[model samples]
Target: MNKAMICFLLLLSSPVIAQKQKTVDSKINHVTVFLSRAQIEREVRTQVEAGKTDLIITGLTSQLDQQSIQVAGKGNFIILGITHQQNYLSELNTPRSLRILKDSVEFFQKQLLIEQSQKEILNKEEQMLLSNQKIGGTNQNLTVAELKGMADFYRTRLGEIVIARMKHDDKIKKINERLTKVQQQIQTQNELYTRNTSEIVVSISADAPATVQLDVNYIVANAGWQPLYDLRALNTKAPVQLNYKANVYQSTGEEWKNVKLKLSTANPNQGGLKPELYAWYLDFDQPIYRGLQGKASGVRIKSAAPAMAMDKEEDAMEPPAETTADFVSTVQTSLNTVFDIALPYTVSSSNKPTLVDIRKQELKSDYLYSVAPKLDADAFLMARIVGWEELSLLPGEANVFFEGTFVTKTFIDPNNIKDTLSISLGRDKRIVVKREKLKDFSSRKAIGSKQSDSYAYAISVRNAKTEAIKIIVEDQVPVSQNTQIEVTATELNNANYTQETGKLIWEMTVQPNETRKVVYKFDVKYPKGKIIPAL
Candidate 1:
C-alpha cells in the first residue's frame, strides 16, 4: 500500500477516548484580599483516567468574577478549557469542620421544636379539662362518693399535666441553650451557609492514567479588607508606636482555614485609564442653589500586591505575645503596597471583620497642648507626625493611647497633602482653660448712618501638672464680605494674626503652676441702616 493509504488506515485504527466526568473538592491555599475584592487561590489533587477528563470543582463563592478565572496545573496532561457556573446542589460544599457545626445546630433546633410541641400539647390538655370541669357534665348530678372520686381524679390529672409541661419546658430550655451555642459557633466560624455557591468545570486531555494537581485562582467580589491602626504613646518624650493592622471580611461559603493570607493595597477594581480634565466654562452663575458649596470628588482604591509563596517559610520575625506584626513582611510596588503574613490564619466566611496584623513601627512626633478656649474649655494634646510618606499608610480610623490608657479615636488620612499628620489625644483636665469677653473693652456705638462694635477677649490656660508644658491659644474675628462692613484688629498682643482669616494665635510654654493669658481685641463697623451678618 501507498504511504497516504497506510496513514489513513492507521488513523482509523486508533482509539477515540471520550471524556469522563468527575467532581472534586478544592482546598483554599491562599487568599489575597484587596480593599473591595479578594483573589482566592485553591489547589485540587485528584486521579484521572487515561484520555480526556472533565473535573468539576465544587464549593467556591458564587459572586466571583467570571472573567478572572485562571487554572494552571502540573501533571502529564494539558488543560483544555475552564468555565464557571452556579452550583445549586453544592450546599454541602463546606469543609468538614463547618459542616459538623451546621449539623449540630440543625440537630439542636429540631430537638427544641419537639420539646416545645410536647409542652404545647400538655397545655392544651390542661386547658380542656379546666374548661369542662362541671363534675361530669352541666345536666348531671353526682352522689357524694361519686363527687369525691371525680374531684380526686380531676386534681390528679391536672397535676400530672402540669408536671409533664414543666418537664417539657425544661427540655426545651436546655435545647434552646444548646442551639444558641451551636449557632454562635457557626457565626464565629463565619462559614457561609447559603444554598447557592459556585463550581469550576475544567476539561483536560491526558494520555495515560496519572494524578493531576490543578491550581485554580479567581477573584471574588464578596471578600475584601480595610486598614486600621493603633497609635500608642507612653509619654511625650518617647516616639509614637504605630501598630498597623487590617480588618478582613468575606462571605464566601468556603472557610479559609489556616491559609496563607496576603493583604494587598493593589485595587484590581481600580480604573486603569488615567483621568482626563473636562471642559470648564465660567459664565454668569445661574440661580441653582444658595449656601451649597461645590465639592471635589475622587475615587479611593485599595490595592493588593503579592510576594513569593512556599509551603513552609519562616517569618521575618517572631510574633510578639500580643501582636503578630513582626511576622508580617511589607512588599512595595510602583502602584501599591502589600503585606505578606507568614503565619497561617483561619478566616471564616461569616462576612465579619477579622483583624489581621500588618506591621508596627515607631514614628517620631512633636507634641504640644492645643486649646481654643472660645470653642472648648479643655486643652487637647496634639502630636504632629512627619516623615510618614514611606509608610504606605491608608486612610483609616486610629485608636489613640496615652500613658497606657485609651484616650480617644482619631483618623489617619494619607490623602492629606500636608507635610505632617496631626493627631489629637483626649482632652487634658489638668490644663484648665477659660475664655471670657472683656467687659471693659466690649462696647457698641452708632455714629451717623454707621454702627461700630468693639469686642475683646481674654483666654487663660493654667497648668496644674508638675511638669512644664507648651500650649497654643486661638481666637478668631469675623471677616467682612461687603465693602460697607469693615473689620479691624485693635490689639494684637504679640499674637500671630492672619489678616485674611481674622484669626489670632498665641503659642507659649508655661511653667508648672503658672497661668498664661492671651488677649486680642477687634472692631467691626457697618452701615446702621443695613443689617450685617453675625460678627
Candidate 2:
C-alpha cells in the first residue's frame, strides 16, 4: 500500500508536456466595408505536426474587435479554443512605404542639425572676436600702420563670418521646412506606424502530421465609406448625367493589397431595432412560507418592425431598386444592401480617401427658371429630376455642373416622398428680374370700425438668352388668421392663386430678348383697434 501511494503521488506531481507553438503569417484576401466599420477576412496556411499545436497569427491592428474573432480550418485537426492578446515585447513590422517616409524625416533632421551647428560655431567666433577688440592689448607702443592693418583684417573676417552665418541660417530654415513636410506626410498617411502589437492565438489538436488551412476573419474599427456624387448637365435640352461614387477609407494597420472589396450599408456597431423578451412571473408582494406560485406572461415581440421614433429620414427604409448597368452588382437583402465590386482593389492601410466609381447614369429631367422677385432679384435655374429614387441613393452632398461650368453645390435628400427631385442649378444672370412697389396704388383709409390698407407691386423678367425659356414667377399676399381680418386679392394678372396659402404663381414662356411684366394688387381690412403687422 505504501509503494502504491508513492507511485500515485509521483505521477500526480509530474509536469505536463507543453504544446508545440508556431507563428503563422496570414494574407488578407477579402474585405467588406460598412458605413462605419469593416470586416477583414484572411487566409492562413501552415503545417501542423501530430499533437497539440498552438498557432499564433500576428500583425493585426490594435483597433480590432476581439469578440469578433472567428477561425475555421480544414484538416485533420480540431480547434480547441482561441484567445487574443498583445505582444508587448514587439510591434508591427514596418512596411516599405512607411520606412521610406521615416528615412526622409531622418535625413532632413540630420541636415538641420549640421546647419544649426555651423551657425552656432559662427556666432561663437564672432562673439569671441568682438570681446577681444582691445587693439595691441591696450599697449600704446603699437604702430599706426599695424593698428590699421589689424582693423582691416578684423573687418574682412567679421563680414565673411556674417555672410557664412546667414547662409547657414537659410539652410537650416529650408531643412526645417522639409522635415515638417515629411512628418506631416507620416501623420497624414496614418498607416501601420503604431507601436502596439496584436496577435490571435488558436489552440488546436491534431492526430497525425497534417497541413491546415485557416479562414480567419474579424471586424475592425476606424474604417468606413461615404457617398459622393457629381451631377452634370451639358445643355438645357439634354439629360442630366449622374455620377455616383464613394470615398472608401480604412486605418486598420494591415494593408489590403489586391483583395476583393464589397461595400455594405449596414453598421454593425449600431444596435438592431428588434429586441427579445422572455416570460416573466408576476406575484403579489407577500412573505409566504409555501412554494411561490404565479402566472407567467410576456409579450413576445417580433424579430423586426418594432416601434421606432418617427424620424422620417431615419425610419423610411429603402424599397427595392432596379439594377442597372454598372461594374457593381447590387444585392438587396431584408435589412441592408451589398454592392459587390467587380475588380480587385488595393486599398492601403492609410486612412486616406480612395475614390471608387460606383456607377454612371443619364437621368431624364425638366428644367425651368424660377423667379421669386419679392424675395430676391436672381432667377434660379431649377432641375426636376424624374426617377432618382430607383437608384438606391443616400442623402449626400452633390457637386452641380451646368452647361459644362461648375455651379454651386446641392444636397440630394432621399427622405422626401416626392416623385421628382428638385435641385437648384444656380442663378441665371442673363435673365434679369426686377420688382418694385407701385406708389400710385398704395393707400390707407379708415371707415366705421374697420381700417383698410391697399398695396400693389410690379415685377418684370427679361430673357436675354438666344433661345426661349420657361419660367415660374412666384408672389404672395397677406394671410389672415383672425376672424375680424379680411384679405382680398384685387388683381392677380391671370396667375394661379391658392387661397389657403395666398400664393400667386405664373408660368410663361419668354422668347429671346423679350420682357414679361405682371402687376398685382391686394387689400387687407382689419378691426380699427387691431394692428396688422404683415400688412
Candidate 3:
C-alpha cells in the first residue's frame, strides 16, 4: 500500500473519524400569533371537542404570545426552548408572569389528562418533599429508600428521575429564587401602579354594529288646585296637586326596564329670600317603579277657608235694623283693599313670620277681602301674583271673623296668624314690627382698586336685622404668581375664609341680623403689560 492509501485506511479505522460529532445549529423558533378568524375557529373547535365549557379568545392568544403551544392528550404545555423540569420550576416561581405560565401548564394538563399513575407519582413525590421540609431536612437527604417508596406508591417509572433532577439543578433553584423575588417585587409594584393609575378605560369599537340610543320623555300631569276650606273662618283654602311622568325608551324603539327615578324640587328663593322654606321634601308614596316609565305626585296645601256659622243665625236672632250709613260704609270698604292686618293664628313653620298691625278693624259678612300672604308659595313660581281667587263662604269653605262692637271682621282661612285678637291686642304692638324691620336690613360692599404690582379688592357686608344671620362673601381675583388674598372680619370671630386660584370665600354668622361686616384684601402680581382683571 502507498503512503496516501495507508493514511486513508488509518483514518477510516479510527473511531473519531468513523463516528464524528455532528454540529447541530440550535434555532429559537419565534412564535408570531396572528389574530384572525381561522385561528380562533380552529381553537374553538379544538376546545369544544375537549369538553371545555368556557373558552376565552383573549386567553388563548395570550398563551400563544408567551411562546407556548397546547397539544391534546398532553400532560403539560410545550414551551419550545424550555425543558419539562425547567418549565415546572419556572411556573412554580415566576411572579406576575406566573399567571401565563400557570394557564399554559393547566391547559396542557387538562388537554392531555395524563395517566392517573403519573399524577399520583408526582403528587407523592411532592408530598415527600414537603414532609422533608417540615422536618427541616435538605433535598439531598432524600435517600434511595424514600424515592423507591414514592415510586412504588405512585407506580410510576419517572418518579426517581423527576426527584433527582429537581434536587441537583442549580439553574432551576436560582431561577426559582429569582422568580420568587421578582414576582413579589412585581406584585408590589403592580399594586402601586394600579393605585396610582386609578382609572379604567373601556374602548368601544367604532366599526361595531349600530344600535338605537335610549331616550327619555318627561311630562307633568294632574296639575290642578282644590280648595281647602278653613273650619274656623269662611274662606276658601286651595291645595294644589302636581304629578309628573317620565317615559324612557331604547333607541331601538323599545321601552327600558328597571330604570331608577328621582324627583327634585328646587326653591328659587333658596339663594335669595326665605331660605328656611328652601327645603325639598320627597314624596315617594306615589312612585311608578315598574315597566318602562314612572310617575310621581306632589301636593301643596294652600291656605284654608275660615269657619262659617251654620244656618241663618241672623234670622233666628232677628236681623238688625237696616242702617243706611253703616251699611254703605261697610260696602265701600268691602272691595279689595290692602289692610295692615295682624295674623290671628300662630306661624308654625319658621321662627320669623310677617308681622303687621291694624287698629280699629271691622268686617262684615257680605264684604270682599283682598289679603296678600308673604310666605313663599314656590321658589320657582314665575307668576307675579299667586293666591286663591275670592269666593263666598259655603259648606266646603268658610271664613273667620273677630267680632267687635260696631265692627264685624272676616278672616281668610289657612292664614298662619301669630295670635288671636285677644292675645294680639294684649301684646306690645311695636315688638313684632321692630323685629321684622331688623330682619329686612342686609347690605354688602365690594372695594376694587388697582395696585402697582397687582390688583386688589376688599369686601364689606352688614346685617342690620335684630336676629342673627349668616352671610357668605365671595371674592374672585385674577390668578397669577404669588397671589395673596386676605379677608378680615373682626366681628366674625368664628369666620373662616378659603382661597382658591382666583376666588376667596368667607362665611360668617352675624348676631340677630345685627350689622356684621367683613373686609377682604388680595394682591396679584404679573408682567406689567399683562393686565389681569379684578373679579
Candidate 4:
C-alpha cells in the first residue's frame, strides 16, 4: 500500500481519532448520569487507544462516580458501549486541552499565594497602626483615622487583598495588646505576693479598760491582710477614748489607714475578691480635740432688814405729834438706845454690797452649802432647787431671791483671783442632753463563705457627756438555714436571740464622755455549691 493510504487507514482505525457519538437503549436498563458524555467518551477512547486496560477502567469508574451513575452489569458484549465510549477521542488528545489544565492549576496556586501574602502584610500593617494609635499624640506617627482610611482605600482598590490584610493586622494587634496586659498583670501580682510583717502598737488612754480586744485588719494590694496578734479584751466597757496606735513593721504605713478596723463579733473573712467592709483611711496626724479650761462658782445669801429688827422702841416710836414739839428731843431719845449717844451719828463710808463678794466669803467659810457653776447638770440642779425655794417661801418672812446668771472665770491656776476673766456664760442654756443613736451596725466579714449567708454584727457605744446615760441596742439578724445569734457584753448576754422571735437587750451605762465597745456574733451555714449575688 502507498504511504498516504496507509496513514489514512491507520488514523481511521485509531480510537483516539474517532468522531463523537451517543446512544440510548431502554432494554439495556443502565443508570444514566447527566454529565459531559462527550468528555467521558474522549477520555475513555484515548486511554483505550494507548493500550492501557487499567487506564480505561479507572477513567470510566472515576467519571461514573463523579457524575453519580449506576452500572447494572460490568461484562456485556454490546457494540453500543464500544461506539459510545470511542467517541470524542480526538478532542481529549488535543494540545489545547493540556494547556487549559496547566493554566487552571497555575492560576489557583497564584491566587492562594496572593491571598496568603496579603493576609501577612495586613497583619503587619495592623500591628503598626495599633502601635501608632496607642502612642496617640506622638508628633511623628500617623493618626489612627489616617491609617484606617489608608487601609480602607487599599482594600477598595485591591478587592479581597486589602480585606484579608486588614483582618490579619487587626487580629495581630488584639493578640499583642492582650499579651502585654497579661504580662503587666503578672509582674504586678508577683510584686504583691511577698509575705509582709508589721507591728501595730495601740496606745489606749489610762481611763480606758486595762485590756481590750480590738478587731483589726488591713488591705494590701486589694487583698485582706489580718493582724497576727490576738486582741484580748482587758477591760470591757471601760471609760476612755480608745486611742488606737497601730505600729505596723516592715510595711507601708500609709496602707494602715486604708485598712478597715472593725470591732465586731463575726470572724473576719481573710481571703476573698470582694471587700466585706469598705476600708477607711485614718489621719493620725490630726489633733482629736483642743484643751480649754475654765472655773465657775455660784453663791447664795440672806438679808437683814428693819422689818425683822429687834428694836421694838424704834418700831413703836411715833412720828412727831407736832413739827416743833420736841421733835429733835423725841428723835434723840428714840435713837439713844440704838446709838452710843456720846458721838454724833454720821455715815462713816459708803459701801455698796455685792452678792458675789458675799458668796466668796461664804465659800471660804465652812457651811452646809455647796457652790458650783449653774451649767449643765449642776446648773440644772441649782435651778430646780431655786424653783423649789420660790414655791416654799414662808408668808411675810421678807424672803429675797436673786436670779443670777453663771459666769466662767478663765485664768491660770496660780494666778490671782482678780486676774481671772470671764470667757463665756449662758451660751448653752437649753438643758442640753446629747444622745447618740446607732445609725448602722454590721459585720466586716460575711457569716458564711459567700455573701448569701446571714451573719451577725456588733457596734460600739460612745456617750459624749459628763453623766451616766442608758442605751438600748436592738437589731434582728437575717434568718436563714442553720443560723444562730449571740450577743455578749459585760452586763448582759443574749444567747437565745433569734431573728424570728428574739431581742438582744443591752442596758449599757456609759460614763461621762466615754466610748464603750460591744460585740454581737452570729453564724450562717448555707448549702454547698451555691453562689451568692453581690449585695
The RMSD of every model to the true structure, in order and in angstroms, is 6.8, 9.3, 40.3, 50.2
Better of 2 and 3 by lDDT: 2
The residue-by-residue lDDT of candidate 2 on 115-181, one tens digit each, is: 8888889999999999999875545778889989999989999999999998998898888888898
Point out where model 1 deviates above 4 Å.
Answer: 1-16, 47-50, 95-158, 166-191, 207-211, 275-322, 443-449, 529-533
Off by over 4 Å in 2: 1-15, 116-159, 184-192, 275-326, 349-352, 438-443, 490-494, 512-519
Over 4 Å off, model 4: 1-456, 481-499, 531-535
Per-prediction count of colliding residue pairs?
9, 0, 42, 13
Shift of residue 138 alpha carbon in model 4, Å:
99
lDDT of 4 by residue, 1-535 (tens): 8999999999989887333222211111111111111101111111111111211121111112122121222221112221113222221111232345445545545555565677777567756655554433556688689879877865564655556667756665665565465555434433322222222222222222122222212222221111111111111132111111111121111111112121111111222133234334457797444333333321111111122112113445675332111111101122111101111111100111111000000011110111112112221211111111211111111111122322332221112223221112222232233222232532333445443232334445545555565444444434443343232222224433544553554545567667655455444444445543421
Q: What is the TM-score of each candidate against the true structure?
A: 0.79, 0.79, 0.17, 0.15
Q: What is the C-alpha local distance difference test score of each model?
A: 0.83, 0.83, 0.27, 0.28
Order of candidates by TM-score, top first? Answer: 2, 1, 3, 4
Relative to the unseen true structure, what is the C-alpha lDDT of residue 335 in candidate 2, on a scale of 0 to 100? 70
Candidate order by lDDT, decreasing, is 2, 1, 4, 3
Candidate 2 lDDT (Cα, whole model)?
0.83
Q: How well is each residue in 148-198 modelled by candidate 3, as lDDT tens digits?
A: 776575545446646654544544455456556655654543432221111
